[model samples]
Target: MMKASDLLVRCLEEEGVEYVFGLPGEELEDLLFSLRESEITFIPVRHEQGAAFMADVHGRLTGEAGVCLATLGPGATNLITGVADAHLDKSPLVAITGQGGRERLHKESHQALDIVHMFEPVVKWNSQITDAETIPESVRKAFKLAEFEKPGATHLEFPEDVADEDVTASVLPTRPRVRRPDPDRDSLTRATDLVEAAESPLVLAGNGAVRTRAARRLRQLVEHVGMPVIATYMGKGAVSDRLDASLLTLNSGPVGEAASAMDRADCVIAVGYDIAEHDPKSWNPDRDKTVIHVDHEPAEVYEHYNPDVELVADISATLDELRERLDSVEGPEWCSGLRERIVEDVSRKPDADEPFSVKRTLPYLREAMADGDVLISDVGSHKMAIARHFPSYEPNTCIISNGLASMGIAVPGGIAADLALETNVVVATGDGGFLMNAAEIETATRLDLGFTIVVFNDDDYGLISEKQVEHTGEQFGTGLTNPDFVTFAESFGIEGHRPETWTAVKSTLEDAIASDEMVLVEIPLA
Candidate 1:
């Protein structure tokens, strides 16, 4: 009998999914058998959470789509963090989980829980497949929803009985829908007029611009119009930091001359920008300005501040049209002066003498990492520092948890890098975040994945501590007395090192890069 699990594998193969990250369980033996018979290479993970993250990175890296699988109950619950991370970041992922027979559902059966509803908000689409013939169609629909307009995760809950049932009906593969966002010509004219009239113009970009392959086009648009570029956290790498007049970072205090100039500018061009994560009050308050918002999605254009003119169009097309419309008008010299001022607002050094200063540490770490090296960062202030200061010479080099902002993503995300790509991978995490996925160190060793894990041992949860300090005048609920991380790594049969100085960090990193085994390097902070 041809089972649903076999049809699921056929559907995955049809969609060009070459790798499957997951853990096998008794409940999913039928699926495992199907996986073994298919062309898809299933990499077993020590934990389901690790499998989920591995799938996330694989999708982020290849641009195809990520796929992950897990057994029923606990395994399904463990994947929530990774699933939510993909959901928040808009990464296209297809997640599958096993369930008990439909008859056992809600009967106090073993390993039975409502996984479909559990993943509802986190996934674009979710459902339970009780009918064997529906497996192929469900798999196809899951991938379709996952790859839809704003790519995100989609899931299918496969019950045990359904996996063994013979499929009397066959469903064929189908291509997913591709969205086309065309720009409004009239909106472009209005935006171009505002740009021509303004003395100082600033371009604030967001992740939306990067999603549409508008990075190079954005740079050309900025350069051609002679406007300074400022990127949100997700938009950090949208414009090259090395490029002249590129003002990306915005720190509190006094708005540097460049940022201050833009803050006070008469015109702010938000290109494919979503101000969800940015502090817009600081950027646009007290200014009599016209905001020309260009976005592929109109909802993104007006979700925050009302735009003077909303250009609902494809980001690349709108920019191209704007270039055509503004050919005769050129920005003034004040724009160049503002860029210099904004650069001054940025902090070149650490604000305080903390043991592991992010300001000072990032530049050193960037130097140690080779060009095209992949850095997977755990969520914290440290990740923000790396995003602002670290230079990625190539695309898709820096992978962080932007969506869902999962803490322990660093380790599993790094493992995914090792599994998918042969490049050197570095996982940087705070002491607190590392503890979340610390057990995955065994997964790394067992797989013999050669990647480096750098634990920023602040001995406290610095992100939460900073928030507490700001809210209460004192830090609370932040400290964590961690065990010896080096000893823990050594116990797992992985090499471990703790560096006391910046020089030692580089030295240990060099050795780790040369090793064919996993290495844990701890950097203790005061």
Candidate 2:
């Protein structure tokens, strides 16, 4: 009879898992040994949070459920932000945690917490394996639900004693992938009628629209109908920003042409749009505009987002069906100059000629990066610039941690992107966001992972400070000091540089991208 931990590893291997990012602990000793002996590579990270973030990005990019492991109590608690990020961002992730024996669970045992219960609010599903025999089904269910539509996070708690229990294990077969049911013809007809009747039917795309299949169909539909498209923060690259119809990202608001287009629109075709990324009220404040919601799942109930036509099906198939129903359509007359103005608004150089300001530096970075290469943004003021100015050509290429929008994801997310895509990854982080997981630089060096980390130093929590200045005419409590980032990178045995001028910035970025090695570039902000 095999031990339950071995059985669990076998189950993971059967699912074709390539990597499990995590930290090690005594409670997970048996499981660690089993994993060490298996074909799956276990990437030991500095913090449990780093492991979870890496898994989150991996799942978001690959569609397979990314896995992470942690010990009980504190280790499991540390995973909350990243797992919650996975849940809210709609990334598929399976988090495994080791626990004390069932005997100690009822009492206030050391390092024991009711993690499964704590995780309920964040994960789609979860369970604790009380009996070793339940491992197969429980593992299967966790992976299944994590990867299912409107995909999110799942969790499994493995009791230490159960992991040590000896038993004959049976491995459940993985279910074959299935396409979602097609949208009803009546729903399509309703959507078609709404599109035909409206004069300016703009497309408001979200993260879901950028799924590879859906992105292709979305581009096709956009061209066929000639509608201007505004992607959400997470949907930056669904339609190529180079195209005339693509209006770049939509957030709370932009002052000029983009806002005008939104206000002028009578119909909004929200494709694979998730409310978690952006509120509909920002665009449809009056709740009077007709909406055609196209996604695999029903829209989340909200007062401002009442869809006149709900086309629930596989996102790609729904777009194909909608396009086939119409011959040609026209967007608002303002669509011609929308992309140019949006680009200009985002790309104008900073005042005082600060070379490394997000607005000034983004164009250099974008010009250096290939269309398919990746850029991961951490939560900070710089992210606003990246969201607005960074032009992405492919889906999942411009990775932003929206929803929970946790800091410290850029570095780990870049690492995961490298592993998942085998492409150059550039991570953009502010001083505040970078320090949150700066220790993970060693993780990248340890794995010999290649990516670029660009740290924008403002010596304060700039985002909050700027808001404070806006409201009160002054900034406070957001100021901070920093060590030399170049030296910090060298300490991790990686190359580092600082570029003072725009020319050097571009050349340095170009060199870094071509080098394909771990490098950090520190840019000072004014």
Number of the top lDDT candidate:
2
Query: For candidate 1, which ten residues in a row score worst on lDDT?
Result: 249-258
Work out the TM-score per prediction. 0.90, 0.97
Candidate 2, superposed: residue stretches over 4 Å from native: 251-256, 346-355
Would you list the C-alpha lDDT of every candidate in the order shown? 0.75, 0.88
Please give the lDDT score at residue 500 for candidate 1.
Answer: 75
Clashing pairs in 1: 89-403, 257-341, 258-338, 258-341, 258-342, 259-342
Q: List the residue pairs that clash in candidate 2.
A: none
Candidate 1 at 350: error in angstroms? 8.8
Judge candidate 2 at residue 379 and give its lDDT: 96
- Residue 395 local lDDT, model 2: 89
Model 1, span 404-453: residue lDDT tens: 67787888888778877878888888888888878878777777788888
RMSD to true structure for each model, in Å: 3.1, 1.6
Candidate 1 residue spans exceeding 4 A from truth = 106-108, 174-177, 252-262, 285-289, 300-303, 328-354, 510-517
